[model samples]
Target: MSLKWVDVQEIAIQLVDSRPGVDPRFVNFVDLHQWVLALPEFNDDPRHGGEKVLEAIQAAWIEEAD
Candidate 1:
């Protein structure tokens, strides 16, 4: 399944799986944005990922990490 910026939960899941042991709480938005773009299943416009979307992704990632 392809991932977009709207797919925050799924992206967070993928991030948790791909980057094990990494704390989402400490990750910056720039790195988070790049990481999402780098995901093999991700396919979306980079511009679509604004601060709100990134915040949602980070929140989901933090939850998934717990």
Candidate 2:
């Protein structure tokens, strides 16, 4: 399934799956944004992601990681 910046949970799941040992809490927004874009299922407009979106994604990722 295709994922967008708005698909926070799906993106977090993908992130946790892709980087199994990584801690989402320590990830920077720059790296997080790039990582999300790099996900195979991600197909959102790159410009659409901002601090708020990144924050949500990070929060979801942290939850998924735990």
> For this target, which candidate reaches the highest lDDT against the unseen true structure?
1
Per-model tally of clashing residue pairs: 0, 0
Model 1 lDDT tens row, 10-54? 999999999997899999999999999999999999999999999
Give me the displacement of residue 47 in model 2, in angstroms. 0.6
> Any runs in candidate 1 off by more than 4 Å, and if so which?
none
Model 2 Cα lDDT, one tens digit per residue, 1-66:
889888999999999999998989999999999999999999989999999999999999999988
User: Where does model 2 exceed 4 Å of error?
Assistant: none
Top model number, TM-score? 1
RMSD (CA, Å), each prediction: 0.5, 0.6
- Cα RMSD, model 1: 0.5
TM-score of 2: 0.96
